[model samples]
Target: MHLSLGFSPCPNDTFIFDAMVNNKIDTKGLTFDTQLEDVETLNRWALEGKLPITKLSFAVYLKVKEQYDLLNSGSALGRGCGPLLIAKRDIPRDEIKDLTIAIPGENTTANLLFSIAFPEAKKKKIMVFSDIENAVLNGEADAGVIIHENRFTYQLKGLVKLMDMGEFWEETTGSPIPLGGIFIRKDVPADVRAKVDTLIHESLQHAYRHYPQLSDYVKSHAQEMDEQVMRQHIDLYVNDFSLDLGTEGKAAVTSLMEAAQKLRN
Candidate 1:
């Protein structure tokens, strides 16, 4: 049977999905019709439950848990891998609340972390993730919350990190921050979901063994194609948690969901 799968073009995603999508490993006779889009777009798509499988931020997952169940594998979860809030110039802590901030998306985990860290920061603008750094540099925004490769390249662009939201999470919760995860539609058969979950786990394993071969695919889609940054992205995101969330990972997600629900209330 064929399934529709959606994920971002980021290096970690490409690296995780390379093997399964490319037939490098056994797929259990399952075929995936893949769609690549930004995480927020994928998140919005999840609202409609259009794609059978897709990648979405933990914040988005909180909004659509009724329609989808997260798979254990292919998750971007770690301590240092959380989003960064940056400014073109160093903004004093007291002035941060007054600064106009740009966010990658309303439903992004970055935005959630930002809100949790600075709930008083009222003004927020949504823009494409790739454009956030330039938006701040061009003076369109006083600061921007950046995720993905921007975490590595922001300082190089003369932007200073006002806060590492991930660090805040680690300090407050003492658990790895769960950024994003893969989700399958609830309507999909239980066995099928298990198969897809296993496929993703195996696919990740295959990519690790054949890491070099996946570089071209990763570089082609990465926002910043620096080899060091790409490798850093992969190394930071794809970990034992990517293979399976295990105990700590699941607790992180639960904590995140509780926090997100509180934000809505």
Candidate 2:
């Protein structure tokens, strides 16, 4: 069976999901979509029951939480896995009020977290991850909500790391960043969904058991991706955080959402 697996170009997920499909361990194949536009695209398909499997960030999942049943809380942008809200380090975290902040995209978890932490901060629109560096350096925004490769590469860009949302959340509320997840469309056969979920968990076990080979795994997925950057990317988002959200990750999400509510003007 061809599993329509929709995902963003998140490094760890692209590699792990692809490896499982490539080896043809159980499923016949996959139709992989890496578009970073919005979860609405995937959610629309999911609402129509077009997928057997898909990934949705918590913010996205919130939009259709009842439409899909979670197979597992997975592929998280774990603790220390996401980018920092950098702003020349000398800038105090609480003093961010009235400052402009660059967000990689609208309606994203980064923005969600930004809403939670820096409600008074203004937003600057930038599409790609790396561009957040340029936006901040050029004073496009006092800070930026970054993700993906930029999380590991920003020090080279001279942005002072103000705070990693992941770190901040852990210290304050303690939870993994619920960045991404896998779920089954509500109407999919329970047995089929269970089988796929089992495969994913099993494959994850295999992926971690041989984590030493992950660099090579990353190389194959990201053709132009540097091994060091890949390693850094893996380090940032994949951790015990992935094994399960555990108590901490759940608290992080709840506190973030509560914080977001308070921040809403």
Q: Highest lDDT, which number?
A: 1
> Which runs of model 2 end up more than 4 angstroms from their true locations?
28-52, 215-217, 241-265
Off by over 4 Å in 1: none
In model 1, the worst 10-residue window by lDDT is: 210-219
Q: TM-score, each model? A: 0.97, 0.80
Please report how far candidate 1 places residue 96 from its true position, in Å: 1.3
Give the alpha carbon lDDT tens digit for every residue of 79-141 in model 1: 898998999777788888898999999999999999988889999999999899999999899
Clashing pairs counted in every model? 0, 5
lDDT of 2 by residue, 99-196 (tens): 78787655567777766666666645655565778878887777887777777677887777877777766676665667666777776677777666
Quote the positional error of residue 53 for candidate 2 in Å. 2.7
Q: What lDDT would candidate 1 get against the real structure?
A: 0.91
